[model samples]
Target: MQQEKMNRSLTLIPVVLFGFSFMALATVFSTYGVAAEISHGMVSGSYLLALIVMLFTAYSYGQMAKAVPSAGSAYAYTQKSISPYVGFMVGWAVLMDYLFIPMVNYLLFGIFFSAAFPAVPSYVWILGMLLLVTIVNVKGIKLATVANAFISLFSLLFILIFIGLSAKDILGGAGTGTIFNLEPFYNPEESFSYVVAGAALLCFSFLGFDSATAFAEETINPKKTIPRAVIIITLVGGAIFMTVSYFAHNVWPDYTTFTNADAASHEIITSVGGKTLASMFLAVYFVTVFGSAMSSQASASRVLFAMGRDGQLPKFFGKLHHKYQTPINNILLISVVSLLSLFLSLTLVASFINFGAFIAFISVNIAVIAYYFIRKKERSFKGTILYLILPSIGAILDLWLLLNLDIHSKVLGSIWFALGLIYLFFLTKGFKQRPPELHLGAAESS
Candidate 1:
């Protein structure tokens, strides 16, 4: 029998919706407090800077997808454009992100729910979310697609409501007494470095937009559609983040006053909409958290499955459930790791995830230059700008952001990368041969 292939019926609209669902519009509020404090009330500036970094990387992904529309995403881009060895390392780095995102969502869910119902412990809420997401992944996450679409729509409505209420409060002389204030974007007393630092953390909020490239095999006219979708998603997500954050800062300019930075969005919501609206916000938040947790858990398991099948780990991780046709072992393993969130903080987890993301982003940016500028020799002025100058700047900015990450993220990320290096050393027998190429079709689930 012929091997099955992904269906090629997804058009631009569906593909764009997939990107939106992956990168949830509601995430802006999730990190609002931390970013506001870190940026010195300049959360909007941080998001704007992060958007510039992502746009450059987005262009590279688009170009690579146009040239090599494969299911591997960043892994495939580096493998075919650069080399298999570089590809393996990049894949490993991205795996760090897929591994931790579920935990981030779990922790966020716990933070919000526990605050609403102080009678219940946070861990209980976290445990419940993890158990639900694990079961959904163990069976299949196709149902998650429909659920995510609904959540995505509701999240937009949620954001719009917040924006309107925030504007109303501003009119009533709250915050800076104006809807648009330059002070929130750049406070004179604080160093501009604060904005850059906040941008590093805020990158996590923009994580899902590039996922459009993963659907190349399934999208109609992928060379065109996928590239457009990726660019549009990046811009749209960035705009939402910047706008929402701008309004958030104006509604509450005193970030330092937040009782708990991690759960600050809750306070802002209640203040803006009062008790009844705040209660409604809590319900919608639960669904948003549920959708994000389930999808993230599913993606993490798929990456583990891909690595196991390639012999990077024990084959047990590669094996699917006999009846469910899913990676049961990997799902369970990730669930166990997610339990760590109960002991961790939000900024730390967000930084940990970005450590790998920046590496992957830098690698993809370099991969573009290596593929087009050197191998293909596109030496014309336009080609030089697109393939050389632009990508180099992207790499530099990504490196800067990587360095800006808190010391803990760098330490942990270094340890994670070091482990990958040791594994590669043995797998390649001391770099005498090429590393094994990963089968990334299933791993690109998100």
Candidate 2:
């Protein structure tokens, strides 16, 4: 079999960065990030506090991405600053982080598509979206990038419209006369710790800033553009999320509006006006989920391809199509796994993919801390704590959440590990059989 390397032809300005943030918002928007800010009276001030934390961490990431634009993302960043073992774990943790995001978006797609087209089965929509993204990605990176750009544009417009419509309702006195009050902050029912936990959940929505870093090899002027993209996408995406979340609930200050166990998430935006606005919002929601899934599929495929080519995975997983110039095997694996995972979810057997994602986040954060600590910059203890300490604490909190995840999730995640380990074992053996001279090519290309 002939080797087919990835094309560095995908030179674009900060798209994957924007797409990452857009996808992240879509992933967590309907959940607590937007929901909490809207219904729980946590918008603006409290949400902004969460944003501050994200901004600091994102700045650190931006600096790192600029310094070393590579495929491994946190793994590469940490390795350069720390050790290869830390890099290995960061890579391991990212398997789920990158893989399950599409799963979350897939679930969101099923829900909103059901709302939009009541007659059709939700799983049908799920399957259709999966097939469509797979085909688009199977074409090549340039095509996938174009698709992502269009979807991201449409999705952004949709979010802005929802925010505008929600604002109209707020100003029109449609809200239940809750006097724009600051009383919620002092209410005994709410505590800072709960708020922090809520922020952690919300933080998930803002967690994809570094996603752009993974596409470093594909970007134009990456050393500069990639980092700028990270910051820009984070701020832009964060602004949209904060604005929507604040007003989504501001239009109806009562938490009861959305907290009901049977509440349709689509109702939050639709109830603001008439069926037209509601329908539009739902349409955007559908595309948002679709776009998120597509971007994630592309990212995941690249990671798998890179790993496979490096002799850290099965060689077949690394193969790029001779003509298409795409990672055909990697893309197929991602699409199949995602669809299978979706199938499991429909059967009520799918585990909590979010647990895997958060675990990856904690791993990345911890990796960053270790990297900074081992650097020979000779910085003071105070500087070290400011950058590294808080992030480590954040990782601990993330671990606590992962520990608290459902049994099915833990079980499935362990299964995922067993599979990875089996593959790793074969990968290790295969490397031992390769001629020493052949190994040099992988190193030089990498």
Candidate 3:
């Protein structure tokens, strides 16, 4: 009997929008205060530097996606191009990211909404966000893409409004009283190391670009479309971040003056755009978080489905719903896991996700060199640069960021890695046999 497959209904446009959903444009404001503080008024430069770091890994991901267009993403890429042991470890590590992301958004939503309505319980909002994302995802990727499209459009519109308002205010004797200024990008008083530190933190804002690769099976053309979508998502997301951060830093020249760094965007928005725009920012930001959670949940489920189908976890997880042809089992499991947010704090959840992400980034870059350069022997000068030099830089950068993670993240991440290693030993029966994997003769799609 033939295996059930994903619906190949996604083309370039919807795919891009789906990626946009994950890299929500509004995220610039979400972390603006802390990033601004770290960069010392050079948040835009930090974001620009972060973008350059991510692009190299993004390119490596594109190459791997072209070679192995599997829903498992970094996990599957590492398994095929490098050691299966390493691939399993990569997947296990990134599962920390894919799994916790929705919970992070859910936690944030609950905290924010509950604050506004005081009467409604925060758990209610958290549950609602979870159900909304789960239902949308379970229905199908088609429905999810439609939701993603709408949210993506709204994000773009909101950013444009912000830029327009910020530019107007700056021109009208506000915030340095000029649109063009170097302070937002460079501060002679601030050391460049500060920018790099801020870049390490800001890299989380660009997480969604590679998540595009998770939908390879559902895409119309995995090889061409996924590659282009990954690069485009990175560039577009980076452009939005730099532009937004530039204006925001200029608008509020004194980052230290924020009464509360956590909610600093609220102060800036209300001050510049007034009460109406402030209200609009909150409302639209809520929706953007919803869309992002939905997108991340969907990606997480697909990754689980890929692993289960390969016999790494359990075969039942591989089974798609007969009607929707979607990973309903995995989706539900992720939703259940998200309930942990009720017990977990936002700071702890957010800290460890970046730890897993950068590890996966480093793995992919190294995989490019191992598979293309060493294994395949693509040794021309161009291949050397593309497959070796570029990926080495990417790996080094990823390692630097990984090391920069807070003590909390490093401690938690190390525990998670140790657990995965232990599980790998049992799964392979003391390393005597290979972990189970299913290699399809051809890619599957509708």
Candidate 4:
């Protein structure tokens, strides 16, 4: 019997929108206060620094996408460029990223949705979102892309409104009275370590760009389109983050004034646009979270499908729906996992997701070095910088972030990695041979 494959239907616009939605532009509202306090009011600076660091990693991903345009993403790149053992491990690590991100997003959506509509139970909202997204994803990628684009437009609209209101408040002398203030970007009281710590936390907000690679199998002209979408989403999303955070910092320059640091953005919105607009903002924010859950779940299923196809996971995961050309089983698995959000705390979910993301980032950067330098022996100066120097910096920064993760995250992540090793031991039969590989036709459009 022949295996089913995803239809190559996604174009650059939908792919970029999907990436942006996965990043969830409204994250600034949820994280702004903590970021501000950690950076000592230098939220913009921290985001800028994080963006610069992520760009190196993004460049490496672009190169790898060009080389291996498949849905496997980091797993495929690491496996083909390095060792299959390492690839399986990378895939295992990313399970945390792809798997739990949807859970986290859904959890947030439940919390916010319930807060907006107190009569409905949060669990109902969570389960409803999970079911809706699972159905859309199982139907096909094109529908998911269309759904994401619609949600992304609403998110962008809210962001623009917030920015406009913030500028009006500043220029009208209600806040800082000037947009040229450097206080949001630099603070004499902020230590370098503080900014670095904030950057580590902010890394969570920038994770979705690489997720574009997970759709390579379904994306039209993926070799060219995926790389461009990855870079575009990262840069565009980073700019939006920094710009919004800057205005927000200017409006609420004193972190001590916030009643609750985590809720500071809400307070700022109320201050700038009144309670009515704040309510509206919260409603829109919920929409962004819903979109994020959809996008994250879709990406997660694709990664699992890639692994299943390659035999790194059970063959059931590799099976696609004959009619829709979608990975129905993997989509169902993610939906089941997302139900755990009702029982788990958001902080725990966020920590483990970050743990997985940083590990995968580190692995991908190393894959670039191995594939281009050690394996292929590419020696041109441009190649040297692209494959060696940038990736080295990316690896170092990712390691720094990994090491600096909170103790709970480190502990949980360590336990997860240990479990992955045990599974690998059995999967590879005591490391006697390379893991099985699945050939899913030629690489997409390379």
Which model scores highest in TM-score?
Answer: 3
Output candidate 4 Cα RMSD: 1.5
Question: In candidate 3, where is summed lDDT lowest over 10 consecutive residues?
Answer: 437-446
lDDT of 4 at 300: 83
The whole-model lDDT of each prediction reads 0.79, 0.62, 0.88, 0.86
Q: lDDT (0-100) at residue 380 of candidate 4? A: 91
Which residue pairs in candidate 3 collide? none
- Give me the overall lDDT of model 2: 0.62
As a whole number from 0 to 100, the lDDT of residue 284 in candidate 4 is 79
Error of 2 at 403 (Å): 4.9
Could you give candidate 1's per-residue lDDT for residues 206-317 as a string of tens digits? 7866666765655678888988988998999999998888888888888889999977988999889988778777777787787667656665565566556656557787
1-446: candidate 2 lDDT, tens digit per residue: 55444556545453553355335454434664344544356544445555766665566566566555666566566555555444444555566767777776777678767876799997888888888878987897677666667667777677777777766776678764443545333235676665565565565676567677777666666667776777777777777766665565566566654655234345675577577866666666676777777777777777666566655556886687888877778778877778764555532333544555665556556655655555534247875775577666656656776776667778777777666555545644743443111121322222
Q: Which stretches of candidate 3 lie over 4 Å from their true place?
A: 444-446
Candidate 3 per-residue lDDT, tens place, 1-446, comes to: 66547888888888888788887779999899999888887999999999999999999999988888888999998998888888889999888988999999999999998998899999999998899999999999889988988898888888898899999898888887878888887889889988988898899999989889989889988989999999999999999999988888778899999999878888888888899988888888888988889888888888888888888888888889989999999999999999999989998998768888988999999999988999889899999999999999999999998988889999998999999999999999998989976464576221
Model 4 segments more than 4 A misplaced: 438-441, 444-446
Give TM-scores for every candidate, taking all chains together and pairing residue i with residue i.
0.87, 0.81, 0.98, 0.97
Instruction: State the weakest 10-residue window (summed lDDT) of model 1.
Output: 437-446
Candidate 1 vs candidate 2: the TM-score winner is: 1
